[model samples]
Target: MNNTLKVSKYLFRDFKNALLIFYGIILAIAVLMAALFLNVISQESGNASFGGFGFSAFIFLFVSGLNCFKANFKFLQANNISRKRFYYANIITLLSISAFMALIDASMTKVLKLIMPYEDIVEQLYKNDLFFSSFIWSFALFTLAASAGWCITMLYYKCDKLMKTIISFAPVLLVILLVMLNNVTEGALGISIIKSLTVVLGFTNNNPYTAALSFLVATAGVLGLCYLLIRRIAIKD
Candidate 1:
């Protein structure tokens, strides 16, 4: 628990300045965009919905991945911290920050309702349950994304140049294969894989709860891989 506290404190201090600047820049841009959108479009008949989880997920992914690179990893290694502790601490930070962002995003609906008069996209889904369920849903998604991002960076960090190069092209290769397969054969292979995964993960189209559960498992797997990578990671790695 002390290690957890230490890691959290370290993260707070480590990224405080950058985080503030990033948030300020995002807020300023958002305000400008909202103002422009409001001025240009009539609110009464506006199909435009403002205030939903937009940049939070991507920001978490980017920030966490960036922070978990050589510098932080080396620092933790120098401190003689166990990989397990380090990983859990980062997980705590991930959940905490993600939840905070989710709360703010959810509150934006109320704030935007005063300015723009249309049913917000996120708010519509949580009409029956409101803040609690919505926050859980959003938090799960952002955490999963962040964990996946961290896992990817870890993969890169632990890899040699050749491996990194191969990994870099992996996404493009996957996409190309998908495209080629589609062209060559009218394939439900991808869809079948997805369906199989959903079944394995207990995800159901009608049940957001099940989807959230699926994401929880996915997040755990990603973060677990990240942890395993760090277990034997060297200082520079």
Candidate 2:
């Protein structure tokens, strides 16, 4: 078998149980939430809505990306796998898992909407209920999350102790700085950024395909950075 294929198979096997356990937990949560909703609806006079479950999957995948690299890299390295092949396998695994989870999320959205007032992120953002559009949007968003997570872990892996600390606080500090700047500008910067994002995401036109394409481009750029970092990364204790 090809080295890349071998690595990919190993990754798939490693994640299989994690994925199943995750969905099992999600299923339990959904069941519990559904029952809660039932009781609430019975008591309430108006309609109730529940949503954002898709975001849970996104968060799960991002954390998965963060945790995937270190141990896997160490194991693969011990087995004499090339870093190039390891990286390739990771890319394939991330994409595959993202798409798989997206499909599940999209289907669940439809099913839940039928049973209750469940609105997914795609529906909230694009205001469209088309299954195909929902799936595409979910796929794009999940892939982006996974890729971004992978890039962050790769950076953490390549950095020293001080650099890791700095990287850890960097996001919070950047947010604070951005907020201060936006306040100084009387929210002009925030508004402008939102406008730009809305345009890039095709919100004004309700075009999810455009947003999906933008997300994919962003993912590609993130993965490209990961490649540069991964190539230089040495196995660490």
Candidate 3:
């Protein structure tokens, strides 16, 4: 109980800092997206509602998790906390931040719908095939991205000189790989993987249970990998 509280406090402190920075970034992005939406509504005579905007919020959350890991790992090490505590703290912090960001995004979307003049814009946004599919995929992508960030941060945590370089470049490399693969392969790989996984899990798109199961599986896998990496690489000073 004491250990949990300690980890929670540490996690909370890190999250406090993250919340401020994340709020600014998300607000700015939201305003920009809103502007783009307005422009689209003006030019195309169609609703500007989009799924990419929501996915961008998730990406920002993942980046914030990376920042928290980089910051908290050093603090924990300096304060003589065990690596186990540090690992748990990181996971707790990441999950908490992700949940908070998700809530903020949902609320923002609702607010936009309420305040904007467009009728049924949100519904139309979800009706689009690309955006609708992305709603299912974004949760998994967000978890994976967060885990990848944690892995990269773990690699750089103990190395002062390489930390900034790795943090800045790793996400870019990952994004580039994903984009190139999607474009060149025509999503064959992605489709195959998703289909296989769905078959293995006995899931179909029509069932909400299937969606929840898929999301849980993806989150568990990412966090499991994150745990292993942290266990292996986290150093005690």
Give per-model CA RMSD: 3.4, 1.8, 6.5
Could you give me the TM-score of model 1 versus the true structure?
Answer: 0.80
Task: Count backbone overlaps in model 1.
Answer: 0
| Tens digit per residue, CA lDDT, model 2, 1-237 | 988988999998878998999999989988877887777774785377778878999998988888888889999999999889998999899999999999999999888877678899888888898999988988998999988988898898899999999999998999999999999999999999999999999998999999999999999999999999988788888
Poorest 10 consecutive residues of model 3 by lDDT? Answer: 119-128
Model 3 per-residue lDDT tens digits across residues 1-237:
677568767778755866687678767866776687776664676544443445676677667556767567667777877777777766666666655555555456556665443322223333322333333444444555566667666656645667668767887998889778977899986788688876644354333335435666777876776677676565555
TM-score of 2: 0.92
Q: What global local distance difference test value does model 1 have?
A: 0.68
> Each model's TM-score?
0.80, 0.92, 0.62
29-72 in candidate 1: lDDT tens per residue? 66775786688766456676554434554565566656655676
In Å, residue 200's CA in model 1 sits off its true spot by: 9.3
What ranking emerges by lDDT with the best candidate at the front?
2, 1, 3
- The global C-alpha lDDT for each of the candidates, from Candidate 1 onward, is 0.68, 0.89, 0.60
Q: What local lDDT score does residue 5 receive in model 3, on the 0 to 100 scale?
A: 64
Model 3 clash pairs are: none
Which pairs, if any, clash in model 1? Answer: none
Among all windows of ten consecutive residues in candidate 2, which has the lowest summed lDDT?
39-48
